[model samples]
Target chain A: DVKVTQSSRYLVKRTGEKVFLECVQDMDHENMFWYRQDPGLGLRLIYFSYDVKMKEKGDIPEGYSVSREKKERFSLILESASTNQTSMYLCASSSVPSYNSPLHFGNGTRLTVT
Target chain B: QKEVEQDPGPLSVPEGAIVSLNCTYSNSAFQYFMWYRQYSRKGPELLMYTYSSGNKEDGRFTAQVDKSSKYISLFIRDSQPSDSATYLCASFTSGTYKYIFGTGTRLKVLA
Candidate 1:
């Protein structure tokens, strides 16, 4: 049923503030991602958008920055938030398969950059 | 090093046991292999989706891909407690669309 929605699920922000994480995918999928899941350092890939205004910079895009004007929305910008940018923040969407087609997540956003 | 090598396991099984999860890769141009199931803060739930190598079941999960021993496996039969959580192992590298995980393995299927 492909449904990825995330606007917030517990965020607190403080140090340097300015964090906006939002992702919406109703299956218009063209490829959209932004991940940051720490703990032995795992899901690192901080920006990806392959359409509407395209953008790319995975592998920990420092300080983070992304926004895909449209196409089911995908935004993740932290510009300043510190505290190591807190943790848990995922948003994925993929379609245009040819193999590696396994990414349809959302339901995360546990930022707490105090 | 660290193209994908998972062993963050908290591994602890009981209920019906028989759960083996692993991952190892140095990137032999990873064909495409996946296994995700995270449920502790949520955001990963696409268990098993293979390509290029071998097995792929979906009743109790079973995904094994061995590109000449690049190694990868995920088997969970009978295990319950909702099968605990965290078990990621992903790969994808050809023209690069990005899909490389594996730093997760925290299963605890007690009962």
Candidate 2:
């Protein structure tokens, strides 16, 4: 089974603190994505990486950035945590050979900002 | 206008009931349609994907897409409590890595 792993399943951070969410996929997928899911808003893409050292801003990329240093790992960075940023963060990965390839997602990390 | 729209229904039904979930899209170029189910506190899991503008069935689930109407539907037969979750509909176009997702409809299959 393809596995996508996030560093933390749950996280709590103080306002103004920097946060890092890590995602690693074992399927050797070329595409990785970060999304924040909010109640009634669905899944909003934050950022995505199609290859190492390449990143693209999604619909809601403000206050967030991404790093893809290796083929199997992608990281989402929050410059400064705020109460409004508390939400469920999801990581997903898919191969490039198929544009409609199914995404394998991590369990997700629910962050609470205080 | 939003590219994709779905009713976020907290639809309730008894076990064995047939459930239908639907989503409409404004993007006519979306050639790929997909359905995902997400349990509480868990990530969304891919359930069905269809590229053709017709119907595809797997097990007790059926995914139907009508490109002319720009609408998609998911049908669940003999629904069970285990099938209760938030169902999300997504659409994708060629050459784009992004898939637009709907707000998701929540279903409760009471046992």
Candidate 3:
């Protein structure tokens, strides 16, 4: 069984404050993804990293950034958090054989920006 | 129209009843189908996956995909309260990182 650990379960931040959400996967998967799950919008991708020091923007990438200094760890950064940025963030990882493999996801980090 | 569509159902059913959840996709390029279960305040956990138009069963859950109709389904047998959660379906084409996910359907198995 693969374990994906998130740094926080609940986060509260003030508007204009910088915030960071961290995630780590035990399995040596090559691909890591960050997504925000909203009420009606469903799960929208934020950023993804395919390799160390590499990153790509997803559908909703505004007001967000990512860092993947290591293969096992992926971090999402908010330069200036806003109330609208408050949502549940999810991290997932998959290996190169993504065809048959499903993305193993972490529990999640729920953020509340005021 | 959305690429993938799922009913935002708060389907309520009694325990030990069979539960059916489904989704439909508009893109014919989608070749892989996946089902995920998400509890409140949690990330989605993959429940099942199918390569194409076929039925795959695992324990109490079965996933079916019909490429001709662009439809996918997940059936849960003898539902338990533990099965109460949101079910989401996803589809993606081969050799691509882009995956389209349905809006998700919420289910409650009453005791």
Error in Å for residue A27 of model 1: 35
Error of 2 at A28 (Å): 0.9
Per-residue accuracy of model 2 over A51-95 as CA lDDT, tens digit each? 999999999999998999999999999999989999999999988
Per-residue lDDT for B6-109 in model 1, tens only? 99979998999889998989878888888889888888988778887889898988899989989999999999998899889889865667888889999998
DockQ: the better of candidates 1 and 3: 3
List iRMS (one decimal) for every candidate.
8.4, 1.8, 1.4
TM-scores (chain A) of the candidates: 0.32, 0.97, 0.97
Q: Which runs of model 2 end up more than 4 angstroms from their true locations? A: A97-100
For each candidate, report what fraction of the true interface contacts it reproduces.
0.78, 0.62, 0.70
Clash pairs detected, candidate 1 = none
lDDT of each candidate versus the true structure: 0.88, 0.93, 0.93
Residue A102, candidate 3: how far off, in angstroms?
1.3
Q: List the residue pairs that clash in candidate 3.
A: none
Error of 3 at B81 (Å): 1.3
Share of reference contacts kept by candidate 3: 0.70
Assign candidate 2 its CAPRI class. medium
